[model samples]
Target: MAMTASTAGRRYSNATYRAMRRLKTVGLYAGVAAVLAYMLFPYYWAIVSSTKTGQALYQFTLLPALDFSNYWQLFNNPVFMGALVNSGVVALVSTAISLVIGILGAYALGRLHFPPGRMVLIAVLMISVFPQVVVLSGMFEVIGWLGLYNRPSGLIVSYLILTLPFTTWILTSFIRDLPKELEEAALVDGCSRLRILTHVLLPLMGPAIASTGLLSFILAWNEFLFALTFILTDENRTVPVAIGLLTGSSRYEYPFGQIMAASVTVTLPLLALVLVFQRKIVAGLTSGAVKG
Candidate 1:
């Protein structure tokens, strides 16, 4: 009888423990779902508002009305189209420049043995943290001196300040983590440093390059303060600045629907880029986290 009683007690304890564990798992999932909803709700609202027109924008409707007049109007706007082109040109050119420079700079910093190399890396990191607003006046003066003011070239040059440091730093970490044996083997086979970089390292750095380039593109694309301060012409403004300056038919009215539609439109490219390179970004980030 006592043995049977003990067996029943053990079974009851095991069942209680499993119940507790199940409850904890449920709570964890619930919390995660809540946090995801909180973070995503604003974007969802923007998408919904993009489909609304006029007074419908002011109303809090869970379901969108499927109206696309706002998108049609935005597409028809010359200013918006010009801004999109300017953004694409500036971002693509700046990302290309930064990646080329970053690859060479990171290679030297990672592979070469020299004095002040660490100091240079530290300086690059320090430069990245400086606020753009602090350097606005100086950058503006330089732009004017270079005769690039109000030009897309000026924005491309200014964006180097944003793209170069991070790209170089991230690439440096990736290069540092790479196996030195391959480079040494290339040297033994009479390959020069440039050849090694172009042949051996470049192919291996596909993920890192994609990650860095994507980040640089996004930075240049979404930049507003410099674009606003430097670009004097409507045709040269990027998407962010153009969206901010969007006007309604009447002076007293704000075109909320058009604004949301523009926002959604500009955001689509960024979202697609991120989604496509999500794995590469993750791999690049975590690759050098632990040293062998």
Candidate 2:
């Protein structure tokens, strides 16, 4: 009788333990869900507000009314279109230039043993952290000297200051983690350093390049201060600056719906890029961090 009682008690205890574990798992998932909702709520609201119009925009509701007139109106705006084109051109050009320079610089930093290499890396990191406002006056002077003020090219040049440091740092860390043997073998096969970089490292570093390039593009695309300061003409302004200057038909009213529509329009491309290259981004970031 005692043996049977003990067996029953063990079964009850096992069931209780499982119930506790199940509750813990449920609680963990709930916590994660709550955090995700909190972070995503603002973006969701922006999307919802973009679809509302007139009196409907004033009402607070979770559901969208499916009115896309605001988007049509935004699309028809010449200033917004010009800004969008300028943003694309500046971002693409800046990213390309930065990537080329970053790849070569990172390779030299990672693979070549030279004096004060660590100091150079540290300096690059310091440059990344320097406030943009501190350099604004100096940059404006330089832009004027170069005759690039009020041009998309000027924004491209200014964006380099933002994109180059992080790109070089990330790429340096990534390249440092690559197998040295491959590079040595390329050298043994009578391949030049430039050849090795173009053929050997370039193919192998696609994920890291993709991650870095996307980040650089995003930074340039979202840059406002430099664009605002340098671009005197509406045609040369980027999306962020253009969005900031968005005004209603009347001076008294704020165009919240139009603003939200423009926000969503600019945000979607970034979202698509992130979603498409998410795995590569995660792999590149983790590999650089862990190995270095």
Candidate 1 lDDT, 23-136, residue by residue in tens = 999999999999999999999999999999867877998888899999999999999999999999999999999999999999999999899999999999998999999989
lDDT of prediction 2: 0.92
Candidate 2, 164-217: lDDT as tens digits = 998999999889889999999999999999999999988989899989999999
What's the true lDDT of residue 69 in model 1?
93
Q: Which stretches of model 1 miss by more than 4 angstroms? A: 290-292
Task: Please list the C-alpha lDDT of all candidates, in the order they appear.
Answer: 0.94, 0.92
User: On a 0 to 100 scale, what is the lDDT of residue 217 in model 1?
Assistant: 97
- Model 2 off-target regions past 4 Å? 288-292
TM-score of each: 0.97, 0.95
Locate the minimum summed-lDDT window of 10 residues in model 2: 283-292
